[model samples]
Target chain A: MVEKKGLSYWLSHAGLILGVIVIGFPIWLAFVASTVTQSEIVSPPMPLLPGGEFITNYKEALFSGINAPVALMLLNSTIMALGIALGKIFISLLSAFAIVYFRFPGRQLFFWMIFLTLMLPIEVRIVPSYGVVAQFGMLNSYSGLIFPLIASATATFLFRQFFLTIPNELTEAARVDGAGPVRFFFDIILPMSKTNIAALFVILFIYGWNQFLWPLLITTDPSMNTIVMGIKQMFPSGDDNANWPVIMATSLLAMVPPVLIVIFMQKFFVRGLIESEK
Target chain B: MRRTVIFKGWKLPILLLLPQLTITALFFFYPAGQAIWESLFIPDPFGLKSQFVGTGNFEFLLSDRYYRNSFRTTAVFSISVTFLSMGIALYLAVLADRLIKGAGIYSSLLIWPYAVAPAIAGVLWLFMFNTRVGVVSWYIGLLGYDWNHVLNQGEAMGLVVLASSWGRISYNFLFFLAGLQAIPKSVIEAAAIDGAKFWRRFRTIVIPLLSPITFFLLVVNIVYAFFETFGVIHTITSGGPQQATTTLVYKVFSDGFVGQDLGSSAAQSVILLFVVGLLTVIQFKFIERKVHY
Candidate 1:
């Protein structure tokens, strides 16, 4: 490729810089608002820079929010995110292992059943699904928050795709070494699947952390509210009295963990995203 | 794609598969079947006795003015978000692809937005455009336009669309950049050697090669806008200002949860089931073609 150092190179840099600024401007404003007073944000043309009330606002949000304490919401979000990620990965790994390695009766039927889960997202079946959850007495429980959302087959399919790529010789070699299927899975397969597992974990963590509608429906209690849904609850019913600073602070707190995961585990995040979608 | 070497015991596999299957049966299939069953009948106002009116709910939904308008709104919203997000992402990707250095920084900056939840994205945008203290709305007001999404239908739609597309740009950008990078440099250089300018080379060579990814993104984005934007619409507009922004998913939640119209909501859910099935089939079909490319 020819190297161009003149106008075009500068033009590309300029364009990308502008794009970054436009993309990042909203979060920057949110940060500034989080640091300022409610009056500053409520009055026209809020200040663009950070203010002195950063600690004050975040403290208020964390200790005692309008509907529920932001601290509790954050904790709820953490538990839900970790539960969904770990639970989905565990089940998907087991199911993918079973489907890929076994040739039992009804295998294909089970595989298709799992695959069909992809077509029916919770949004489509909100009413009946809610009723089912209520029937099981899972409402307001973490199980309610996590289990319904985990039935999807994205992770299962991802693991299945990965397990297919493993050579058959590995399985044969393990059998020759007098290892049972369970032993072989524990000794060889799980160790080999570390990268895929990590990658999927990254993507699944974000997916779980960012979930909104499901959590919104099941958790009627303020204490059970995830930060993402809890933010909306902070808004006054009639309007014009939104607690901007604390809401903004809580918003930033809501974004921090998932955003940090994406930044730090970026390579895995990208690989997992592309692979899962494929 | 099954492995040749296999596990022998049916019992072990069944045992392993039980958790997922149980969850799927209990959560996915049962609720889905219930939705279909409930869709066929109209429950009277009292919860005690329900008369079975086969397909009455579906019939009413298909004819209801608001339901039809919601379908249209969903179509318009999905198309707008898909195109808007994809177009901006493609533009940024092209620029990033042209850069010989520092692409990683721009990518790292841009990609984090994907982690922001759609609900949070809505809140952030709503803050910026809030009529009273929203900086952008204030600026618009200074420009002599009353930027009120509360009363204005078009502005409400525009705001929600923008909020929905904002976070999605990062996902599309990452894919587009990967697609751009996957294009062999030799092909582009060869086109360049044939006296093609940048725009011409991009048009004749780059765009064609990028079609598979573009198509994949299109399907995924439409699915996203259809189902996932519920959070965005919920937070920002709540399908507000006279139902101008009420999408199909929003309508399902509003009708079922808020209005307690179980029969009608079940019918809407059944309808969405077919819509999603159709989209998934289209995606699989395109992916089959994509393999040959």
Candidate 2:
């Protein structure tokens, strides 16, 4: 807390400025490339500023792309992200509520089962999981894309942690009001869980939006490609040229929604991150 | 973990839990159980008949050159990305901490990258460093270094690691900044009064206090590098110039999906299962301590 406003102060400012530039450089270049011609990008040292072809490039990418249109991919990504976020939150909420409020036969067993899911991320178990989904004929479908990915340990864990912190007195008070468990949950717990839900929503939305490998493996159909996975497909195979401007545009489009969420709902996102960790 | 609450039910609670349980059984438990079951059997690539070879896949993986190299490569990549990202993040965080004003701005600028997917990050980095047309590669060439990740193994590894670290820097930075800001200024002021310089005060007081977060981040970052960087490696190199960038997770996909080596891939998955389990336990315990410490 020493307020020495001489060399050290300026140095710190300079350091952060430098850090910001270094961190932002790649994205900035990508943005510039997105707005430029392929010739500009393919030639050495593409112009470092935004070009006149911004509308043309993005229009080309979103309307008609290499394999599937970027527009379709964006929609796919939206559906998948929203589905995963809402689905995970929905199941986790009910499960957490059930585990926390009820003392029933096999309650502990069920809770442990949900807890067990926390460790086996899809990356670890993708092959068999893919097979299981395929057996159910869910591959390339939204159900296959979303359902297999929705069993989140942390979301339920966060909700469980949250439910534990709610006073038992609330339940007792609801009981005194002649309310049943379901009635009490709908009337009280869900309302009180607004902040936690919002926070978790922010984090889960980002997590869902950013999933790449699962979508890549599951959606063999080009029409079903999520924007995140679809970007990888934009690269032409073998010696054929990569459409850099379109790819860059698609990349930017893919990042926009999630990045906007993080920026706008930063407070909730941070709270969600910290609380979920706990 | 128990709640001293009032609700007592077998039917409604069970009903409420059924959906989650069903999904878990169908998706998580069944698949995981199947992975373990399949790991013991070597099914032919044609998916017709299978022979039971208990622990054969594990033994083969341990002895197999590609698998061993993947494990080693994964270790090297994990350590590099974890340290490189965390180190730069800590530096930026410290610098931001020094500023009484504009720290929030720096934070806001830095943290948005947390939203960027690892695959997209890889593309951005690859675009910049792609030998023929890459801007950075051109600049580096001007500096007399031929930066071709296509043919160069080390360069390929470095690109994926950099791409992975770039997106991760934001997450680590957020935690580090939070951790840095949490340290009491009174302690630092006292150190300064005792004639301790900035670096000395930071070395003695700040670092010791920040160790809990650093340790927590270490575990999180390693888990990230091990599993989550699949996208980064996939996009940039596709486990590249002679499998140079193929970490453990990438190898799982490459062998299982690409090569269709079901038994061997299942074995690798089982091994990753243990790694994740161990990390989760450590993370859970450390999280408890984090709450305490």
Candidate 3:
């Protein structure tokens, strides 16, 4: 019933185009606001298109922000995000390897313990977790930002599931080759898990970069602020004026790294999301 | 699903498991237990000692008008966000699936918003609807609707929910699209040959096939609305206009951190823990059912 230039074809295209526009409109508006001057944005009906103040607003935001330089915040966010992603991947790989490949006491107990973490997201235990972190003198440091967040049950479980699918013959062959567990993991399992690790990295990096309440609660120091949480700090309290252009610029900057990662690494990202949830 | 061949070592395995276990105990179990513990007592104003109150904090929370209002607000906000985001995502996914070509381009464009942090989404939405300078509000004013989220409670709730749902649309869209693509073409062809129209075939066949993904998204979006919308509420309204937009998570934050009511906050956390536990159980059970299918 369908023709080359049919009503259904045109209608589907029209609907899809509308969906794309609606989805992209907010980002587009934010981009325009970032490019315009403060006065232009403060007045009603801010310019819908980009303005001449792009470099000025961005430079100001990067060099001297309301509390701390946006550059420093970006650095802090980068450090935290990378730290969490790598730390989680490293630990999850080790634990999953241990659980799957080795016979050990409390294996089931440890597995169950990790699974229990899935229910207790940081949001649920935020207050006491803050207490625990503070009691350890970790507040406002990179470790405070990174350590508590890196205990990822999801990542560990994903790796554990992957490890189970590995054929038994491979491990048997490795042992027959006089290779011990360490050598086998390094030479075989590690190399094979490269794609999964890369995929998980994409997912975890976004997770780390997007962390809000945790970073907000722990990092009281302006210099320790992540770009994501740092944007909120720029808001003017009470009657003071807000520099909308710079604040918008900061928002744009906060989105750039993760957005780029998602766009460029769409394959790995989609795989990581769907598979991890599964 | 244990592996057949295995390594025979206790030391190395323990070593490998050490870091994950230690972090989990310190961060996950310890704080969770502490939340349960602290929920049972009222701390002194000086923060030195806590008096055992049993369920006093929970009683206080249940009787508190503001706390009850927060519970209602969270219910409404999350339900709105879940339906709005999922509905739009499903529509887009259906259209994209109908296309034989260029679906990838639309999918790519739509999905990047998933990468935008929820707080940033809030800031962007706030800018667009800022009472004085927001472009959208200015247009709404042109249409003679006073659009001040600053002063209006409902508008504040709407704005935060919209912002929260904006980023989530991408996530739901991806899953729905994948679900749609996985349905067999032969099934649809068979239905069409039986004289079923597009809508009829869709209702009778496609939607049933897609139910698993839909159910999964429901739980995920609800969980997201509960916990992840904290950043949105904090940035957009600070749960403001007289706490009209405060979700339970937001209440815990404001009470525990800002109000310094640790006992009440801890009690709220315990309630939330149970809520999460219930949702997790449902999700795992549903997953087990799906595996059988």
Candidate 4:
């Protein structure tokens, strides 16, 4: 029995090691491809280690005059991401507080309506949504990009779930001390649910930063484009002479923010998931 | 007293709902309604002449071989991607759950793919699969299978699916890993005491308990497969190889934006909306009930 158990454990360990390799290979390849020259990448048996052309490749990618500067694109993506994150978090907190703390008429109906939007995939609405943005004269503007995505259903839902788990006694005590609804929310509720807010912040920031489709449709001008769009523009459609080293470098540049965000907030992200389940 | 209390209670919700309502109305509702209206009319490119076609666009779409092919391709794309990625993600999640060390390293590395923007990810994959310079192509040549995603429909579809799944697995893996960890250890211990084999214990106990997470992941994955693949598909394939890779959303973008057939594009959008809406409702009605939670 002991021998059989040891054998099974060894098999599971082997399976896990193989699974990790499969998952990790693409990421390793991405890093390797970023460092090597375009020619080295396509050669027979592909280079297995990092090459010395990293600086040249990066400079070529950054200075490719075909589109907006990489620095400007990164700045644009950061501004857009921060704007959307702030809007989503603020709206979500207020709404979630109202839903949880107040005994509102038709509250259930409103909640369900928002929840329904959660299931409505953006694909179904892209064409009409584009028309709406165009009609409002928001097509090329940052406001156009930020406004539509600000009131995130997922953030609101997650916040509501978090708020519900908070003890009503705390809020009641604050109310007893003559605190208004706004005061109670700002002072007590928001502070207590800081972890949840942080978690949602990270998630929404990543989503906004990585957004591509709507940004692609709305912004035709290179200056207004986000990093994701900037990356797409780097490799012009069907151009055989497109610089691979530059493409790889530009792609690696685009990856920096989200990767940093993930690494920094991972602990909170996991905690947020665990808390939401509760 | 009751009326006053009700009014007081309702004010907060009303206030909170205002921003969401405005955004949804303008961005979600109005556009959706406009698309439906536009689908019924034929409008010229300059937005000048307009004539009511009244389901003519639908008829055209229904009969068109290209639209028919897109529908077939979309089904194949969504189903295969969702199942393939979900299966792999679940397997990895379960294995990760059992391990006591290096879990964070594995999780972080696996999720790095998720951090890569879809456009960038597509570009990276495109490089790796390039005919002359691609690592995948070099290996494929070595293996004796002439493969070029740009020229072959099946190859294009495969690349899209592979890329799409690569982007998705990280997010799905997180949810599945959390779900696995949430399952009570006591139940497993009891099963072990009853002399149940590993496969039997997992099949009868863990699988059933993980249904809620599985169902949520399935719905989310389906939605992603439907909409989120557009960017990558556009970047990598542009619905190419004779429109072999064009899913419904890709078709909508092309028809409306590129082809300048606003009415047909609107019609296609409405069809997509209906399909997604139906699936969503079915998911809630049927799958939600099956969830253990």
lDDT of each structure? 0.93, 0.91, 0.92, 0.77
Task: Write the residue-wise lDDT of candidate 4 on B238-277 in tens digits.
Answer: 9998999999989998988789888999999888878877
User: Mind giving the per-residue lDDT tens digits that candidate 3 earns over B131-218?
Assistant: 8889999999999999999999989999998999999999999999999999988888888888898899889998999999999999
Give the TM-score comparing model 4 with the true structure, all chains together.
0.91
Best candidate according to TM-score: 1
Error of 4 at B1 (Å): 22
RMSD of 2: 1.3
lDDT digits (tens) for residues B11-109 of candidate 2: 888888888888999999999999999999999767899999999999999999988899889999999999999999999999999888889999999
Pairs clashing in candidate 2?
Answer: none
Across residues A187-274, which tens digit of lDDT does each residue of candidate 4 receive? 8887898877788777778878988887888988888888888777777556565666666677778888888888878877666544
| lDDT: worst 10-residue window of model 1 chain B | B1-10
Q: Give candidate 4 misplaced runs (Cα > 4 Å).
A: A1-5, A42-45, A63-65, A100-116, A271-278, B1-16, B286-292
Give the worst 10-residue stretch by lDDT in candidate 3 chain A.
Answer: A1-10
Alpha-carbon error at B233 in model 3, in Å? 0.6
lDDT of 1 by residue, A30-58 (tens): 99999999888877799999999999999
Per-residue lDDT value at A200 in model 1: 95
For every prediction, compared with the true complex, DockQ reads: 0.84, 0.80, 0.78, 0.49
**Model 4 misses residue B150 by how many Å?**
1.5
Q: What's the TM-score of candidate 1 when only chain A is evaluated?
A: 0.98
Candidate 1 regions with alpha-carbon error over 4 angstroms: none
- Give the TM-score, chain B only, in order for the candidates: 0.98, 0.97, 0.97, 0.90
